[model samples]
Target: MQIMSNENAHSETDLRAEGVRVTRQRLAILHVLREASDHPRAEDILTRARLQDPSVSQATVYRTLAMLEKAGTVLRNEFDGAGARYELADRHHHDHLIDLDTGVVVEFQSPRIEQLQAEIAAELGYEIEWHRLELYGRKAT
Candidate 1:
């Protein structure tokens, strides 16, 4: 995933395009997501939003996240035994490699892997509509 720059961020416009009303609380949540390179959970987002505006509540943060997810403006990733993590959904398609020890996520793309997936689906007489690939591993020592 690419880090969104302040000048190029499209959270506000994306929300409006999705017919969602733009509010301060929602904007604060979006700001937190846009500025974060690491995918953060809803609670983490709530903490950052509260720091930005003390009046912001956990309910509001969760509600906004759901709205964003519905609108395809954010992606919610749920790793094994770990709570969901949120990131902006505007980047190109990529797969994740999760660090099992530390819960860190690394995004990568491989043409060979993509081709093999297509070939396997074809061999099974199925056309792929969508797929998610997540590999769990530890960092090289």
Candidate 2:
């Protein structure tokens, strides 16, 4: 299963805050990402963008996504060797549980995991700056 936050979904305002210029193609791409619940690949964004504006092209989606990711408004993840998937970066911090067979990404947060990471980091003489955790498995039958 995939969980996504629709609240404060990426908007033109976010782009402007990052000093990104709002254009038609970029808006189409951002709109697609805004409406998505699951991590979508560049191809998925391109397909969705084209639905709203026939002029949206594959290259534009890729470029726009790259620009957004660089601007810290989008996150890109690749779990279990799957291709890159994108989501809005403004969401609360959470790790991913990826279903290997179906390619589903489930988001979750655990205080215990955070505490463990902090303890481990302290043991190694370093304060945790950031981290990304991914667990891969299939549905239990």
Candidate 3:
């Protein structure tokens, strides 16, 4: 299982392409997300964004996150019924393993699992539009 990378780092131009109003706060938020491997919550984003631009606000973080998710530039995951954690949507398809005890998220890709899902979908006479696989577990005792 490989952790995600900055392969899809976004910029102000991305927001413009998404037809969003580009601002310093938004750019700082984007920078924070681009540098994050661990999917972060809005509060974490706001805190990091403020480090990049002191003018960033909590409302702006939430609003920008909503805009990015709506624009399909970011993805919101509610693992273990937890508050939304976010990651860039452009990364290669992968599944997650959440540490139930520590609330850590690990990203991994598996072709065998992908093939099995496709096979199952075919058996069900349905096509998969999209899917999310999350496994919650703890370290071996």
**Deviating ranges (above 4 Å) for candidate 2:** 1-6
Model 2 residue 71 CA deviation (Å) reads: 0.3
Q: lDDT, candidate 3, residue 111?
A: 82
Compare candidates 1 and 2 on lDDT and give the better one: 2
TM-score of 3: 0.93
lDDT scores in order? 0.83, 0.84, 0.87
lDDT of 2 by residue, 1-141 (tens): 334344547667767987999999888888888788788889888888899998998878888888888999889997766689998888878899898888878888888888899999999999999999999998999
Number of the top candidate by TM-score?
Answer: 3
**Which stretch of 10 consecutive residues in model 1 shows the poorest summed lDDT?**
1-10
| Clash list (residue pairs), candidate 1 | none
Model 3: runs farther than 4 Å from truth? 1-6
Rank all candidate structures by their TM-score, best first, as comma-separated numbers.
3, 2, 1
Give each prediction's root-mean-square deviation over alpha carbons: 3.0, 2.2, 1.4
Candidate 1 vs. truth: CA RMSD? 3.0
Error of 2 at 64 (Å): 0.7
Per-residue CA lDDT of model 1 for 10-126, tens digit only, reads 667767888999999998898898888678899999999988888889899989999889988889999775899988887767788888988878777777887899999999999
Using lDDT as the yardstick, the better of models 2 and 3 is 3
Candidate 3, residue 124: the lDDT equals 98
